[model samples]
Target: MMRIWPVFRRELVGYFATPLAYVFIVIFLFAMGASTFYLGNFYEGRTANLERFFLFHPWLYLFLMPALAMRLWAEEKKTGTIEILMTLPIPAWASVMGKFLAAWAFSGIALALTFPMWITVNILGEPDNGVILASYIGSFFMAGGYLAIGSCLSAATNNQVIAFVVSIVVCFLFTVSGLPLVLQVAQAVLPTPVVSAIASFSFLTRFEAIAEGVIDLRDVIYFASLILLWLGINVALLERARAG
Candidate 1:
């Protein structure tokens, strides 16, 4: 736990040491503002619901989360730091957990910065705070799931660009699985149950429930399990790489 704290502190500080964190926050604010205010027609339509903001998240995270996670292990491997890192007395799982938590917390900060939108909604109309809070919780867990996948992919390669591209592709597949385009394609050939099962695995399917203010236990479990599954895979990959 002590070793984990040092790595977490280092990675958290590392995020602020570069322009990456600033750039990400700025772009994220712009994207959220544009989506909710201009494109979402929140002002003109005067909708109290946060559908517009939540709608844009999967696509936004599909790109931005990968950028945040691309350097996790890829940069270490590329600079020969992984060799030295492995020599430390830290358990592999602790290192993976520490780094993953740091990145997840960083992403959570970016998500929290969008709170102004929630404030705006409350000021404009009688927004349901309960639902809004649930939605925020859902978004945070979803981002963690995406980050776990990105961390795993980053660990598998030394090139940041390759890691970024691969993470984006994998995340994209998860995001689009339940969309009409993908479901339509699946329905054309697969049986009804199979198609339904495929769509059920989508990120959208799980998130949409929370976006609607229904904090179902099953949905929470699904996202938590998704995060843990990928993190376990990440640990295994890093361990294998170190051994090899």
Candidate 2:
């Protein structure tokens, strides 16, 4: 943990040093507002809650998170700085954790910027602030899951575009695994228990539970486990690159 701070600080600070950070935040905010107001019919419903706001997060992350994560290790490798990073005394796992945490923190900052939406809902009517808070937590965790997958893929290739596209494809699978259409197909060929297991693995399933103010321990565990699993893969990939 101690060794992780320098890398964490470096990467976190590096984000603000470039225009990429500002552009990403602007795009993310605009996309969320547009989706909520237009596609989600936020004003038409005249609802007090942010159901429409949080509903689009998984879809938004499909594109946004990968774009943010595509630079994690891809740019390093592209510029030959990865060799320098690997030669440092820090263990590969520390470096991986550090980088992942930085990306996650940046995402948390972007998510926090959506507070005006929360405030708007409150001004419109008496919204259930508890559920809104839980949804924010769920969204943050879901972003971490997306970033973890993207981080691992970014480590696998030097091309940022490849990293972004592949991450979206993989994340899309996890996002839709619980949908009725997917389950119907699985149910036809797979047993009930097997199909149920597939549903449990879906990001939408876990996140929806938490978003609804359920905050189930299982949902939290699922996100944590998924993030850790992908980060472990990320570390292994970095270690392999260092060894070679």
Instruction: Assess every candidate by TM-score.
Output: 0.96, 0.98
In candidate 2, what are the lDDT values of residues 131-221, reduced to their tens digit?
Answer: 9989999999999999999999999999999999999999999999999999999999999999999999999998899999888888989
TM-score of 2: 0.98
Cα lDDT listed for each candidate: 0.90, 0.95
RMSD of 2: 0.8
lDDT of 1 by residue, 1-244 (tens): 7889988888989999999899999998898888777777777776787888888888889998999999999999999988877888988888888899999999999999998888888888898889989999999989998999999999999999999999999999988899999999999999999999888779998899888999999988988898889989999998798678
Q: Which regions in candidate 2 have their CA more than 4 angstroms from the true location?
A: none
Q: After superposition, how far is residue 111 of candidate 2 from its true place, in Å?
A: 0.4
* Residue pairs that clash (backbone atoms under 3 angstroms), model 2: none
Point out where model 1 deviates above 4 Å.
none
Report the Cα lDDT for residue 69, model 2.
Answer: 93
**Shift in Å, residue 58, candidate 1:** 0.8
